[model samples]
Structures are given as structure tokens and as C-alpha cells.
Target: MTRLLGFPIADHRRVFIIALPMIISNIAAPLLGLVDTAIIGHLPDAIYLSAVAVGATVIGFIYFLAVFMRMSMTALVAQNFGADDMAAQRHNSINGLFLAALLGVLLILLTPAVLELSWWLMVPAPALQNLASDYISIRLWGAPAALMNLVILGVLLGRQQSRQAMWLVIATNAVNVIVDVWLIVILDWRVQGAAVASAAAEWSSCLLGLFWLRKSLALGWHHLRLNLKQLLVLLRLNGDIFVRSLTLQLCMASMTAYATRYGAIYVAVNAVLMQFLLLISLGLDGIAYAVEALVGQAKGQGRSDRVRHWCRLTLLWSCLFAVAYSLIFIAFGEHIIRLLTDIDSVIDTAGHYLPWLMVLPLIGHWSYYFDGVFIGLAQSRGMRNTMLFAALLGFLPLWWWGQRFENHGLWLALTGFLMMRGVAQAIWLKRHPQTLL
Candidate 1:
């Protein structure tokens, strides 16, 4: 237990307060995808599900790359709050939204190139590619709105306004799910309908977030002016995060591509399995988000002891949750698989892959927790280097050799990648003890 003012304090309450809303938000984030999957999976053909998988994977890659905006904004805002620098916090919020708008437009403009490049790399079948193209085209239009929401959400989390952030996420995802069902099931618009629903929900969230920020921070347009030096720092921080995100996205895209090579059934199976993994990762990330704000604040206040205390408590909670998740997966993996897709073939194939899913929580929790710690500290370089090492030295080569094992090999390589990420980051922390302290 940590002590303050000569009294013992329970860290779990503090941590849980920050984490609970985020846990709901994080879980809701993936439930959006799961909803899309469940909606599309019931269609007569597996192609609809496969197309959604590939299209969503590509868009997810692009959007995730822009996640630097969210991560950087949270850390900067949290640090500013810790230092009692209201002006700087407001400035960061304004500039973050501005940057997000810029990046969003760029993503929209590059849609054609992105689609061309994605098709080239993925080499999906003609029918599947056509459906995927339709999906991506519509979804790309939402990039700006989606990215803007990321920045706003970051600001909320950084300020420890978790309840507000939680409601925003819940509302946004609820809109997506309702619209998705109406458009796809009621109107029979299929893949394009899913895209439209997502875009509408994204824009709604962005607008709602801006409205919330206006009331919460009372921000003024005059404060949105660009600062070249601050912009440089933002870019530098986001640049490192970009590299880190790129490597992570590459690992993900590679998994999808490799799975595609195995056949559409495998691709669909992998897609469903990946959702389970996403659910676990996002749930764990709730804790990481809490750590990001808490650690960043601690760092800003020069409270090294508080930082250490947070790290210990967060790691303990993460391990316990990982155990709980593993047990749940082990017991209900088949039932969950069946729930995601009604197709006997897809369900049966995914069942064969359940063991990997069952074990993933245990192996992957460390890397996820450390990610929050590093992001909170705003130490992007270590994250970048470790991911590079993990992807290039650990995952890719292992994936190559594991090809003999087919889909099993792919899962094995991914497992190795997760383990290596945690191990390498641990070594990095050992070498630089000041980060945690």
C-alpha cells in the first residue's frame, strides 16, 4: 500500500474509478466491430462477412495509424493539468483538433491511392475486392470526423473526465449499432450500409465531442492559433508514435494477409477470432488509459514515487484480469464463436482456433500495460524501437518458419510477437530505470 499524509491509501479505488468508464468505452469500441460482424455474418454468403473483414481491417489500419493524435493529446493534456498550466492544456486541445482535421482531410484525399495500394498488397479475390472497395470508399469519407473524435476523447481522458468520455463512447457506438441494424437488416443495403452507419456515427460523435468540450473547457477560437514551435514538438512526438503505430499496423495487416492466403473460410475464421482478441486488448487498454493519465500527471508533478506506485498497482490488476479473461475464453470459446457467425463452416473453423484465443490474454497483457506506461510518460522512442525489434526480429521470421504449420503457425508467430514485445520492453525499462521511477 502507498501512504499519503501518514495514512495508508487504497490505490485500487483510485485506479478503478479512472479505469471503469474507460473499460466500458474500450469494450464498446470493439463491440462496434462485433456488431458489424454479427450483422454481416448472418447473410446467406460468407463473402459479405469476408469483405467486411478486409475492408474494416484496411480502414482500421489507417485509423489506428492516426491514433498518435489521441495518445499524444492525452499525455500532453495530462502533463499540463499536472503542472496546473490551464493555458497549455487548452492550447494542446485546440491544436490537437486542428491537426486531427488536417490529417482527416488528407486521409480522405488519399482514399484512391490507399485503396489501390491495399488491393495490391492484399490481393483479395475479384468479387471480394469489389465488395471491399465499396465498403472502403464510403468509410473513407468519415476519416476526418473519426480522427477529430479521437482528439476530443483524448482530451476528456487526459483531464480525468472519464464519465463524460464513457457516455460519449457509449452514445457513439449505440448510434452505430442501431443504424447498422436498420440499414443492413431493414433496408438491405449490405456492406455499403455498414459504411454509412459508421460514418454517420463518427461525425455525430465528433460534433458531440466538440459541443462537450465547449461547455467543459469554454475554449475560444482565438486560442486555436498555430504555434510553430509547439507544432514541431507535437509532430515530433506524433512522428515517433506514427512509426510505432505503423509497425503495429503492419503486424496486423500482415496477419490478415497471411490468413487470406489460406482461403476465404480461413480469412473469415481469422476475422472472427481477431474480434475476440480485440475485445481482450481493448478491455486491458482501459487500465492502460488510466495509467496514461495518472502516470503523466505524476511525471508532470515530479512525483517519482507516485509513478512507481501506479505502475505496481496497475500491473497487479492487469495480471489478475488476464487470468480471468483466459478462464472465460477457455470455458466459453465455442459458444462465443457460434454467436459471432451462424455459418456452420465459419463456426467450426474458428472452433479449431479457440486454444490460441484462450491463451492470448495471459501472453499479451504485459505489452498492453507497458504501452500505457510509455504513452503516459510520452516516451515514444522506446515504444517505436521495441515494436520494430519485435515485428522484424521476432514476428516476421517466426511467421516465415511457421508457414509449415499453416494457420497454426500464424497464430504461433503472433503469440511470439506479443511475448517478445513485452520481454523487449521489460529489458528496455531495466536499462532505463528512470522511466518508472
Candidate 2:
């Protein structure tokens, strides 16, 4: 309903322009995990597959915690861009990189303790634990590069330069796939090969991102100084986002732990299904990312009407994609599951739960969309609180009751978590519409 020059704005075109490249980039992301899974799945040892699965999940949790850097950077940069404040944008980029570097180093230093704690919590089979530990240890080396890349990607997305962002993602995943195939399949190095492939890819992308940033921004070194007030604001925004991400990760980790308790077969099955879930979420997140940039820009320009219009269009596209994705999963999930693993037990177990994957998009797409809207509006506190309530009140309680149903209970709890997130956030936003202003 946004009008320009007495005509309706073609916001869909704007959304698609940003969202399309991101969708491809996001799809490529899960392919990295799938390649690792497939390569290890064929290695004649279920432990190898389970090890990579658990290790990746643990590393994912760690990396996800730092996602606030990306989210906050995106919001800050987009708003600055809208106001034509190139200086603020430059400051944000530099600060984000610095923060990412600091966090990445801290993660590296804490690797031993993290691995110890993760193993204690996961309690995988002995063989699985050892292999997983090795994977986590090796991948931790890339933490600095990986976190920096997140900031770089955030900068690109915030600028509405999604094409470059897409290229970066493609290049990164291409490296991951090539290395994974050569080391895991050809050399038969197993889980270690996959970890090495991922680490190598992370550093590769980081370097590429640095080169791109230098060329794109062309900023002098003098422009990179940190602003204390902005840093404080960034920290507060990221703090809320960190808590939100933590709660979400807790739900994911809890699901993994519950699945692990059912034995390696279930763990592997859940991992495969999780890939599908990741694929959907990331794809939907593409739309959300587009919304963030567009809405943040509008908000910065003091155009509340434009922000609302963009949000409406984004949600419509998200719903359409959700319906389409659900159908595709219902039709071809079995085929996809088989492609991910050759272990017959893993394949069978995953197929039995394919229905959950099919319905997940419909139930969860709104949360992804809403997250973008909130981030664009700098409503991190609402995001943090909504996730807390959803995880603790909605997910944990449901999980407790659903545990009686075994894996079914686990899936149900997860579904509740996703649905509750969207519902709670919706209610909160409705009650406090000023947050969007």
C-alpha cells in the first residue's frame, strides 16, 4: 500500500531483488553440512556420521551466540545508509569487525572448556565422543575467521549489496564442498577431513571478505576509530540478541540431547532432518534479511508507512514460500533423506519423521519473518523476552510432557517452541506497536 508518485510501490520487486540472491546463498549453506554428512555417512561407521553431527551442532551453538554481531551490524548499517550517514556506517563496520575478532579469540581460548562441557552435556557414545571432540577442536581454530565473515556478510546485506553477499557465500561453500569431497571421500579421512574442510572454508571466506571490504568501502585507516557511545549502544543491542540466540540455541541443543538419548540412530536421523529444517529456516531467513534492510532503511528515513508496507509484503512472500516448501517436503523428503545418508537405519528413522519437516515451515516461518522486522526496528529486548518465554514456558514444559512419547515428544516440543516464538512475538508487537516506530 506504499505509494510513490501517486502509484503503488512495487515492494515485491525490491524484496525479490534482495531475497533471491540470499535464498541461493542460504541454500548453499546447508549443502556444506549435507556434503559433510553424505561423505561421512558412507564411511561404514555410524560413529563418524554421529560425531560430525554432534560436533557441528555444538560448534553451531557457539557460532550462533555471536550472531548478534551480524544482526546488530545489519540494523545499524542499514539505518545509517538510509540517513546517508556513510561515516556512521563505516564506524559500524569497523566496530563489528573488532567485536567479531575479540569474540572469536575468546572462543578459541575457551575451546577446551567448551568441548569438555559439551561432551558432558551431550554424553554421546564413547567412540562418538572422541571423534566429535577432535572435530570441535580442529574447527575451533577457524572461529576468528568465521566470526569475522559473519560481520562482513552483515555489512554486505545491510548495504543492500546482496549480490556480493551471495558471491561470498557461494565461494565459501564451493571451497567447503571441494575440500570435503577430496579429503573425506577421496582420502577417506572421515570426520577430521570434514572439520578441516569447514575450517579451511571459513578462513578462505574471511580473507575474501576482507579483500572485498577494502575494495568496496575504500576507507582510509583513520576512518576506523571506535566511538564509545556507539560501542555502548552496540553492546546493549547485541546483549539482547545474544540472550535471544542463547535461548534458541538451548532449544536446539536440548533437542539434540534428547535425540542422542535414543541412541546413535536417532541422533543421526535427527541430524538429517535438521538439515532440512536448516534449509527451510535459512531460505525463509533470506526474506527476513531483505525485510531487515528495507524496513530499517524506511525507519531511518522516518517513513513508518513504508516500513509497514514492506513488512506486509514480506510476510506474504514468506507464507507463499512456506506453503511451497511444505509441499516439496511432503513430496520429496524421502528422496532427500536417502541422499543425505546411506545407513539404512538412519534413512528409515529420518523418513518416519519427514512429516514433521513438511509441516515445520508452516508453523515456524512467521518467527523468521518477525525476527527480521524486529531487528530492523532495533527491538532486541522484545526478541529476547519472546524467545525466553517460548523456550522456558512453551518448549520446556511441552518437552517434559512429550518425552513420554519419545522422539515424537522431542519433535512436538520443537514445533511448540517455533510456534510459540511466532505467537508470543506477535502478541508483544501488537501490544507495543511503538517498538516498530
For model 1, how does the per-residue alpha-carbon lDDT over 1-437 read when each residue is reduced to its tens digit? 78743334666777778899988777776667677689989888899889988998898878888899999988888777777788878778878888989988888899899999999887999999999999999998999889988899888988888888898888888898999999999999998998899899999988999999987777777776876666777788899889989888778767777887888898898889988877786669888988898888887788888888778878887898899899999998898888889999999888888999899999999999999888888788898999999999889999999999989999988999999999998899889988764
- The number of residue pairs in model 2 that clash at the backbone is 0
| lDDT (tens digit, per residue) of candidate 2 on 154-193 | 8888889999999998988889889999998899888999
Q: Give residue 23's lDDT in candidate 1 (0 to 100).
A: 85
lDDT score, candidate 2, position 246 = 84
In model 2, the clashing pairs are: none
Off by over 4 Å in 2: 1-9, 32-54, 123-135, 177-197, 260-269, 333-355
Q: In every candidate, how many clashes are there?
A: 0, 0
